[model samples]
Target chain A: MALNLFEDKGCPLDRQRFTWKELVQPPISKLDDDAFTRVRVILMNGMEMEAIRFSHGCARMNRKWQLPLAQLRIVEQHQATMINGLLGADHSILETTIAYEQVAIEVTAAVAQNEPDEYLAQVYRFGMLEDFDHLYRYSAMLDRLEGKDANNILQCYTDIVPGRPTIVEHRAPQDNLREHYDRLRAAPITKLHALTIMSSEQQTQNFYLNVAPLYADPVVRQLYTEIASIEEQHVTQYESIIDPKETWLEKWLLHEANEVYNYYSCVQQETNPRIKAIWERCLDYELGHLQVAMNMFKQYERRDPAEILPGDLPEPIKFESQREFVRRILNQEVDLRALGTQFVNKSQEGVESQQYRQHLNASGSPTDMVAAGYEWFAGTELARDGEITREKYTRGHKITH
Target chain B: MDKTTVLGKNRSGIDISPIDIKEMMALAKVTPASSSGDEQAIAQMRQEYIAGADVLGSVPLPSTLKGMASTAMEKLMGKSPEGFIDKLGCRLAFERTGVRLYDALITKCSAAPMGAHIPLDRLHEFRNEEFQHFKLVENVIRSIGADPTAQTPSADVDGVISLGLIQVLTDPRTSVAHCLEAMLTAELADNDGWRMLIMLAEKMGMEDMARDFQQALREEDEHLVSIRQWFKEMVIKDTVGT
Candidate 1:
């Protein structure tokens, strides 16, 4: 049965404030494997939804009612700190990073398969490979640094392989733009999907930006720098797909709805009782947020909230392994590139020449320097599938780096 | 133009660029289609969309009506909405079943006696993997512009599939071996379904999808093999009077 956020008894805005003690709650232990993935997903989803609100532009909200929105911004900042503070503990940042990539790989591939627009599907598939490669690169690091199989961390659900190599993921930002969806005509799910991914990629970028420098290992740091820049491109690529024409009120409504939907999903699927309680509480809190947004829509925009969202919500978003779904995309379009508003074959006319050099330079070589570390430690390159020899990379420059 | 110019000189310290106004006006012009007052009709239409989408192109339907409805939908929406919906529904339903099946299996295994060779941790590990698979599929469905709600057509079968596994829960005599036997049936079906999906995707010219399904196929193959081997060792070894 579906949970209705609108009908739920939610805390009023005045009552929603948290004390410092409540805000800085202890982090869920990293040892709780399931909770680890759930926490990362919730944080990532919140960040994504929050991005939509921050980027939203409202002339009407700006003209007469700037104070309330400004106040709301402060609350948003407070919530952000609270969310990030949950990860503030000295947890193994490496495993958290793995969970992030695992989420990216599975989510990106699922989006690719289910996206109604062929172009959007292609766009997602393009990024799926990059994120997939990141998972593989990080898995190698996990083995070398911690003497742990990435599978132990990854649970072997996501595959370790080369996506579009990170070396070539760097690009002149303007080249990342793709055609945008029509907010009025496009399905609401499409808008949410694009923004959700944009938010997730931006979070990944932010993560690597801060965490990369903290690492003393030069090679690992370099890999972070490489992938972080790629994430910036990913953010640009995914965000460009969102219709800039969406009104501030429209965007706000969708953002709140997304928060409610995601939290509801967590509440249903979360196995850990403690984490599930958090999801439930947050779902209620977000319902209050949605109510405020709904009132604002009615008072300012003079439209019924149901017009923006239906009387009932669509459905909860879910996270699942898209290993097969992603594999299908990898098999077909590992060679695709985004060119302005269109996705073109990598060999197409207007594609940049420098990118090809980056691809070629990195092609025969393993994407990560971990191979060298693995070789030095184990006397051979250690991979999830045992020792990596010339046979692995010699086959082709495309599938294996 | 600078931010001030586009935002109309930042009146009252609230930035409202001309570009922002321009963008908002464009959106206002293309405003979403207004909702009608017929709540029942809307709900019915939603049901129709889910049902039509779930079996679209895969099953025989009321031809004249269904074909006309689909054709009209195409002209209106610029695509066959049902086909994509059906595909997503199937993915979501299958993954959800995988999750639930694992949950039931784990519970049954943990409670049953005789940990002799079958490590409970191993069951927990597989269950965890299935949960990951569920999450991945769910994300894909959401990304593809659909909800992973069980109300969708293919998702409706989640209950049916879960019911098949309920025997492990209801019957006290059910062992990990019996659970494996039950799971083998599911694993085989999942394997075949994924294989068929790959073929369908390839035929549809979705090479990337074929690759994605192949990865899933590899995992499901492993799952099938593991379950078959376990069932023989844990259940069949004791039952056949050997």
Candidate 2:
């Protein structure tokens, strides 16, 4: 039987079933590689105050604080796999491998060029350097894990030249960056995501913690553990950026709702089933996450912020702007307030009609108000297009105006 | 039926008259005959009368006032007393407004048929409750040396009440739910008004009234419990049906 990625089953190849105890031992021939040492040092050398400040600020703005532990683990696992695959691939897969890289580079360049703040440029530089370090660590891990030569993996990393028009110099570049960040932040954290990453880390962490047990061969388990710790550190870094005041439940719920909205929006607009399935599954995961969060919130006797706070409630998600709404109807985007005035005027006329009055008297439903407004607006549009005569207008005036 | 059997016959050396036995039976029957009806019919009538009677009986008395006052006092001690006072003012404002709205509606529909007047009657009952509520809260505030009316100006009072009335008339369930939410909010803000009312009454030396309000709080809790249980059951039924 073939393994299905969508379902729960063990790995396709059960090559070596290593216990937690055996995986953690250190290797004997530990060569201190220079580049790896440099990256590690950079990660460790940050000022305590700077770290604290960054952690505090990030936590406050950290939107994913409420995400379930299970979901975070899965995302981390997926990210690891993606990183590994990108680094281990040949020249043929280079184009696809560098897509995310290109995005990061472009964002960094744009920030550097357009941002007036010197400190912001420095921050971007630091972030870009960290991204490169991640790329290196991933490439190294991929080489060691597959028993492939380091030279081969290094070649794979270097073959794709950094794409140009790299720096965003435009005034509105920050807007684009903000939008990108918003979209990235919207992914739902799920139990599966959390479990996968944690399992992988557990495997890796076990390998590193028991350094003395496994001696001779390349301490592949130790290396895995070291990499896993880096991942955990990254997780902690992200978690720290999220405010501690907000319970994990609050953060997860917001993320889940956003994910569901995004998925539905995409599902409605996109034609591809595969793309739709991805979003649909995401929507399922988000809903599950929401249920979990709700359970936790109830246990604590705390209401969902979304339920209590005015702005926390979900707004109706819309794709089209005012311009789009007008363009679809009037061949151009008119001033929305002006359009509203026209609508209100037509509705006023409709209010005087017998049908409108009767509807109001019978049932004072908001739906009736909306329908009356729409009919009045439609009639106005028809009159503007010369589709109806004055006589017809007089006739309609009795029923709908 | 023999009258002698109905009442126990007195034994005497002399022959007792049959008239005496009849008279004794008549007196015995009169003792049990305060109100006359079939047992089931009487039981049904009693249930009907007691249904609304509990509403009055459950009201917190003066003794319960001290516990309620203590709660208010505790709230006053901990945070901005003004916030609590303002909320009480808002409640009073809404109650007064509800009364006026119900009165106006009743006046407008006086000529309508009895069938049409059912909703009006409900509104009237609710308005009457609101009036009682307004006075209750006002008295509570007054006991604490604050005037609820002064806190809520007369000009804004009508507008606030009208808004609540419109909401209630549009969707009674939603309006009731809103009131529940407000009650919950107030209780939470003051560390449970029901509990506090009991505490205040006890503190103010109104032990009996305190006990009454405690009973009222228990009744309120029962009502809430039933509403929640019913809601849950309905939701389950709906899901299953669907």
Candidate 3:
């Protein structure tokens, strides 16, 4: 059933309140819970984080709207806390990192398939491949460092293989931009997809930046630094695709509708009953937020919210294995590179990005060093019980240091 | 679910995801590594950094007063006092962390559904001994006029190492056998830490401190034996249904 935007008034912002105990609910079981639950938790946290960020940005620009944005921002913060707090203490940082990459690969793959505009979809596929490679690098790190398997977190829903290699994912700032979708002509789902992925990548960028220094190992630290730089480029690339000409109120209305749409998607597919309820409550809250935004649109812009939003929410984002889609993209576009807002063949990649990457890798690429001839086995690389293939196997491998 | 170990939807293995694993292995085989070489590349990069890296940090001067610290260093030893001080600091930190590990283990045991005949009283006895050992180390550091609260480089490293053990003990999902193994790890390290302190104290001519450490080492030996035994018993019982 499609959710009608205007008919369902939802719980108003003032009524949307959470106690500390309510905010800090019991975490999902690391070993037993579905991996997609963690994916939803991570993605929604990204959503709430963006909500707070946009609210603060909007408040700074529109002085008269500061109070309403403040009210909305507080709710968003608690929502983020409640959602993110569900990731249990049992997850080591590296384990949680594997889950983060799963979100990047699986969720981005889903979005890439659904995006309406060909150029924007290409942008997503290009970025998705980069993040897919990141999953492989992080998986190898987890196996070698912590003596754990990434599949434990991934649950075999997403494959632990390389895609467009992270070393080649780096790009010059100018080369990273993509053409923005026309706000007037673009499908509502296209707008939501842009916001969702950009928010996700931005959260990943901040996550890598925040946790990078906590690592004791130099290579681990460098790997995070390198990936975090790519996530920054991803953010730049993703955000540039959102139409910049939308008015402040117009953008705010779209943000609310996107939140409602995402929570609706989560509510539709969430498997765990407790987590599903959380999604349902959040869905109602987002609809309420949409109402508030609608009122503001009327008062501030004197326009109907339907001008930017759909009468019915679009089909929910699919929460399933994107293995076949990802494998196809990997086979076809692994060599594609960004060239001035356009994806191009590896040979056609501009000299500027190539030179930038060379300088960065001058000391040796950590992503390369960490995953050298790395292969993911069921248990881990170490799970090859008694097999010893030394010296001869590593011969002719790349990267001297 | 009450059993610590069960055969269920343990999707982490190849059995449930045989098709996916096969596909993944095939893809990985065909895909060339992004960069090059082997694990040696990481070791080589790490070697360069390790060559240039500084030590963790310095031990605090006695009471953090420079003049008093110099005097305290003299009191602790006339020869190689920093080495002795660093090891003593390490012991102090480990003993303290050991108490907390026991606190977590006891809580986990009570909450555990299988709560096998774990000797809670004996666990208490062990926990108190750890606290006593911590107090002893604290007094020894103070007697040598070094600040017991100061974190030496060795202490910092011990903290980093104990993180995994603490994580295992405190986690609710870990079983009795799992936590017992974690406790065994702590006890084993704690035993060696005490023995090392005793050796260092004797080497530095601190006979009284050496004697104090010898007593702590004896208690730590008991802890190691008991944890190892319990871990063995639990794993065997869970596996063999004995």
Candidate 4:
């Protein structure tokens, strides 16, 4: 390992704040190689913290909750400073938009890879295809509105292909729920995975909600609104997987352990020393938080921390490529959907559609507008994937106007 | 159905493997319980097996070599599990490489001197997009009841390609122009992967899947556009300075 991540001492609260000068330092190069993944590690951490910080405003915490909440705010602010310093001013909203999409892709995969249950994995896959399409739709906007190519930054690691069309992704809220895992017996990683993915998707939804109004183009704004709705459904899908039986204190403990575990991961895989230091520092801060949370759990729940957490955190999570794995799944299970705890193919009867028409009637499909915009400007309905994998998956499907 | 039978069941006894469970659930004929009075008990035991302990039961997880071997054995035995597992492995590997590439690029950009003109934020955005793709691919893999960590032949191909990109970062002499070129290679492969997937899904009668894959491919085309533009910018800047 490059460095041990479980050490206790962190930068004191007095030292966590960075000067404006430091925050404005040069952003990482577009070609530095580790820049995006490093940002992902940071962002993933941020998302989890944000989710954990707010999910437990339960009556049980009383005033004692204020302490951890204050601690969370300090650490969160420091994390924001670190990320802002890394971002600099050179990026545009379009760029941030693209990065947001990438975060969704990478983090969702990380959780899916770590998830032990097939049903939970299926819930994620349904949303994955929708976001994949969002990236493509937004790429079209980047080209049409800015007269700029989307690939300048994409660099071909992700194929900007369509997934389950955004047009059909919207569904009734009640339909989104999947069966919850048994908290007592479920893998700690699975709970952590659910929390991680839920927050990441929530962030994506919030990003679109925040930025949609900023865009001048109607289509751009509409696409954001359209996709943001799907993300809302995704949040519901992922959150429903958590066992509701666990006490808020138990959830808090898992949150802290999860934070430590993720920071440990970033420390292990980080190649850049500068970024690695940030991860290392944050890991310590999170460990402190974990210690505090552990004590609270013991006092409140009257249970050993080990009762909820595994003896040792499982191997640190890795964010590696899943190219073949995705392709294999696309071939076999592309048509599957969630029903109760089991995943069934599209042909199964419980696949409800009553609410879809009303939803579509409320607003003309933004996905249609996206396709129309592409046709009007690019003379084609679909953008090409270029030289990555062959565009062979959608061949027999109809391409409607 | 008894607690003894349930508790005594080996952790591995419930076969919830995506492939096996899917196939078993689809069977039309259930041997009408032997006319014995034990039929009700047997049926209840089966129901409990499916609903209660099946998910908790442990089974061998997916790994690259094991997935490959499982795939091969299924084919040999004429009982192929869904072939999606292998394809997802390839995508997961490629998306990770994409995320790493963007991260490296972002780090370098952030460290560049104040005087060095760079689109630092644009690079950050690109990295984010790749991360999203990474998540999407993994989600697809898990949806099919396989772990995304597994390696396969196609995934290895992606790994080898990413190895080359890492080489560019390691060598101090390689400049932004060289990195751009490496990115171009990655993008081309990504485009092909999406295109191929879309076509494959369509052919398999998965119209809904095809539409979604099409949406992703559109964004991929834009990725090619930006990468090509960035490369041109780097070349122009390099020529002027040199």
Candidate 5:
């Protein structure tokens, strides 16, 4: 049964509590759990992080709402900790990176298909291809540098092929923006999709920035810097799709609703019962937050949240591999480029973007350098026959005292 | 922690999701790679970078005149003393890490069922030897008028290589046998490291230092055999279910 957003006032804000033990539980096994489990963990963590970020921004803008926003932000911060803490320590930075790209590709692909507006769906397809290319580049680094297969992290669920060359994903700030959806005419689902994807990309950009310097390899450090720039562009692209004219209260109501929608999706499809419980708890907590937001909306704007949110969520975002849809998009839109508020063919792309990318790649592209001549086999590239494993170095002069 | 590996929902392999693996492999076959080539291009690029690469770092030169005299004497007698001091720094860092690894092993071993046939005293002995070895290398580097504290390039690289061993040792979830396996890797490397250091010292005309390193090499040899035997016994006991 679908959760009724209006009547089901979930665990009240006062009763929502946590202990330190609850915040830092045992992480899921990287080898044993489904890749989608990590995907949900990463995405929901992004959702909670976005919630806290939005609440803080709201409090800063409106001094009257500071106390209530402070109350909500603390809970949201703990929720982010509990969700983000589910990733086990066994994941090396590069391995966790593979899972992140999987989230971007699969979640954005799912959102693209379920989107009702053709223009918005086209926007998602464009960004998804760039993230898709990042997966291939990171996978090559994992294989060549670490001698590990990305499919171990991907679990054969997501494709490890390129979508668009990341070398060209750099775009001018003007080229990155897109037309916003009309708040009144757009379906409730359109607003939810835009927020969900924007939150996810914003979190991805932040993640890459935080972990870029943690790498010891120079090329990998460069690669993170390169891919993180694209993620920043994606955040710009997706955030622009949200109606900027929407009231702060309206945006807050949608944020709470989107959190509920995402956790509900995770709960519906989560196979691991332990992780599923966390999602259910987060969902109930998000409902409580929604209730608070709804009351504030009525007091401030004198409008019903039903005007902004559907009575129920549209549907749980599908958490499975979107291989067919992704491959088709790769075939169709690999050459598509962004102009102001629109996607264009590569030839028709804005001159500003062309100069921007050319300057970015003036020295060289780390994505190209790291992934030059890279291919994916069932095992790592080392498994391929006729490949040089150790011969190229053994013939060098032996060091003798 | 469980003292053995038990079968659970281990889903990393292709076997757990047969249907999904087939679907994935089929799609992978139909989907072409973004660019067509092999790993040779990666190597060539790496070679180019290597050609243009900066050194990891420089060996710190002696500052005091007394220290300078010591370094000059060694250089006059043999090849450059910088490589020797760098390797000594590597050994010193590894032995320091070795002490910590043994401390972790002893703590976990002492926690094992209140004297459950795991030799805590032997781990203590090893831990002390590791500390002593660290001190010996420190004194050796200082004797050569080099900074004992500065992280040499070789030491930095060795730290990178031993990171996984530290992970295995410090993790509370790893069993005694698992730690022993990690210890075995450290011991085997330590033994080889001592033997090479001894030969290097002798070639550089330091017979007294070589003799001290020979004693350390013999202790490391004992560490290797004991850890290998314990690891084998633990695995066999788990396997035979006696």
Candidate 6:
């Protein structure tokens, strides 16, 4: 059964009220080898199945319905390779640290060059910050492995960024509004660039969720859990961007295609044999992801769910409409501490709320307070505040609460 | 082998022009299209022109130049092999290879489980293009000396085309990306060939053949460009999305 986050009769707090803290927890124990293996298999298998299924679906669709199957296949193959490559990286802390650093640099450069829409830019920024945390977590894992200081391992890697041209070169300001609009629309469905932030976040979520459960050490497992939850937040942000009305299949397919395309493109340009091998492996993995998605679709085929749920659907998120997107640049600043404080406060409040108490009591209940909270907050205060603050933010300003 | 005397004197009286005879030598490398054109007359004229040229036999050229010179000499020496049979054979073989390759991929992709490999939709599209390519080649072959219906199957043709595709698909550097790069190369090569055929037809006053090849060439070029662009976009998308 699907996990629902909205309905609970026993919560003392109003049906709609909750905090972020109630939904998350820090690592309490280490992950054993069995747990790790299970999660890894599940995640990797799911991802690969999705990739293959999507590609096959596309081909079949083209053959039966006369779509551009060849072009779509090319895109699908590309995305598969990228996802596989990332997965193929050494699971060691040092390797993940380096990989994350490289991804951060690449994302930063892309943002600098294109100045993507506010949500996209925010996702990139968030992703970069998350990578730092990931670096730390992995370093901690490394410490556990080597019986040394995690901080030192982290410092060794993080220190390298300051000395390099970490940002992308600037291009001329684009006057082509239509082109930009098309880019934003097409970006999500295309290869690496997503139309919305959630798409990319899903990959992170899957990565952490899978890897977290696979660690043999408790500390490593805890760290993975923590990081995975953070990634889940990013996924939430992305999900909030999408229309809730979309069917699970549609959403899954789009995300799957996006991932496959990314890997496909990366492998194409990657000259390093190690990287290339990873890409090839990723292609197979993504194919699996597509297959999983297709199977899900097949399972759901008998049932008629709307393409998007009414509550889940929203107006397409746009950077132009997001005042925060504009504010970061105009203000030329972001208050990281302020944002952190807000998140922490909100989380603490949620944890203390009566609704959370009930949620804990009815842990296995079908009702989902978390989902409810997401809808309520996302639809009401959060949307309004995000829009309002977006106006004040400039292109390069630091984000704040 | 005096470079200055052979090339003619420069204003500075220096041997500014090198004694490279490759370019001059290549001028002789023309294959006759028909035995009916006064072969002896043309050869005599070519010889006379070579003798009259001050640089004749004055300087030896590079290996590449010598190869061209040999080709030129052969063309000058032989009568125009009457008929376009050889050209037709080359063209037919090339197009047939494209058709076969696409067909093979379609079969291969189809055999794989849905989502286990490339989508069937794309394979179908490729098959369509392959059919078109095959038709174009068939028409070319019929227009020349051979009857498309009567032409005997040659194992050599199959080997050459399949080998080329295998080379492309197996290359680690080339195969890393999606098959887009490989597809692009094939399309571009076919497009060039089509253009040449069109030109040849026009020169021969076979307006129908020229028109057909011309149209096919244009379409092929567009397909090539579009696929290439699509491949490029795919790369960018993959890079960014990850």
What local lDDT score does residue A186 receive in model 6, on the 0 to 100 scale?
33
* Cα misplacement distance, residue A249 of candidate 4 (Å): 1.6
Provide the TM-score of chain A alone for each candidate, in the order shown.
0.82, 0.30, 0.96, 0.82, 0.96, 0.40
lDDT per residue, candidate 3, A272-378, as tens digits? 99999999999999999989999999998889888999999999999888999999999899999988988889999999999999999887688988999887777
Question: For candidate 3, lDDT tens digit of each residue in B63-143?
Answer: 523455443346454477678778888888998998999999888877766555788888888999999999998987886
Query: What is the Cα-based TM-score of model 3?
Result: 0.92
| Winner on TM-score (1 vs 3) | 3
Give TM per candidate.
Answer: 0.54, 0.22, 0.92, 0.56, 0.89, 0.29
Query: Candidate 1, residues A1-401: lDDT per residue as tens digits?
Result: 77554576466666667678766666544433443344454454456446435634443456654655554555555556555555523245676787788778876776666678887887888888889777766755665665554543444355555566555565655567888998777866676678667777887888889898776445556667777777888888888898888777777777777767666766777765765676676677767777877888889889877665654554555566566677677677777765666766777625463565466446323234443322111111243235355565666666665
Q: What docking grade applies to model 4? A: incorrect
lDDT digits (tens) for residues A78-100 of candidate 6: 44343343332213443343344
**Sliding window of 10 residues with minimal summed lDDT for model 4 chain A:** A375-384
Residue B78 in candidate 1, Cα distance off native in Å: 88
lDDT of 5: 0.87
Tens-place lDDT per residue, model 6, B68-163, is 333322332233222333344455666666666555544543443452234457546655765776677676554333345433323244334456
The segments of candidate 5 whose C-alpha lies over 4 angstroms from its true place after superposition are A386-401, B1-3, B63-81, B110-117, B139-147, B200-211, B239-242
Q: Write the per-residue lDDT of candidate 4 for residues B1-242, one digit (tens) a residue.
A: 00101123121111313343333223212212111232233234345445644221232244433544433233223323235455556776887788788777666555555413557777777777777777877775555446776676677757765876877754444556666778888889899988887766655555765786677778778777888887777676555533
Residue B184 C-alpha lDDT in model 5:
93
**Candidate RMSDs in order:** 29.4, 37.9, 4.9, 25.8, 5.6, 30.2
Across A308-339, the per-residue lDDT of candidate 2 in tens digits comes to 11222222122221211211222211111111
- Rank order (by TM-score, best first): 3, 5, 4, 1, 6, 2
lDDT of 4 by residue, A52-97 (tens): 4554454336676776656666666556566545653334566667
**Cα shift from native, residue A398, model 6 (Å):** 50
| Clashing residue pairs, backbone N/CA/C < 3 A, model 3 | A397-B37, A398-B36, A398-B37
